[model samples]
Target: MGLNLRAAILHNVTDNDQGQLQDTIVDAISSGEEKMLPGLGVLFEIIWQNSSEADKKEMLETLEQGLKR
Candidate 1:
């Protein structure tokens, strides 16, 4: 069940069958739409809640770098 949930969540990030939604998300994030940061926060919360410590640390570093921009 958890695995399925994880897949579903990540599919939004990884799916490429359609381009617009993913492109929009990327553009919004790159443009620093402050509202979109919370979406990233929610995604991070999901990962942090379920991932191993090493994975969480890796993601934390990535997110920290992104937030620094």
Candidate 2:
């Protein structure tokens, strides 16, 4: 299969501004459809790659706390 999900996702979001990106995340999460997970994961991957060590640690802590709920 020649399908590259990451490239496709990035292409779709290439022109998105901050507000548009926020809406994309909010919509995907609020909808809670299983299909949205891959997109969310791709977004997270981008975020993770760009984040600093401290930011990554904070995100991990926040995720850990949320998972306990």
Q: What is the TM-score of each candidate against the true structure?
A: 0.45, 0.95
Tens-place lDDT per residue, model 2, 9-66, is 9999989999999999999999999998999999999999999999999999999999
For each of the candidates, the C-alpha root-mean-square deviation to the true structure, in angstroms, is: 7.0, 0.8
Candidate number achieving the greatest TM-score relative to the actual structure: 2
Indicate the TM-score of model 1: 0.45
Worst 10 residues of 1 by lDDT: 1-10
Score candidate 2 by TM-score against the native: 0.95
Residue pairs in collision within model 1 = none
Model 1 agreement with the true structure over 1-69: per-residue lDDT tens digits? 245655554676655444765575677779897867755665667658999989988988997999999
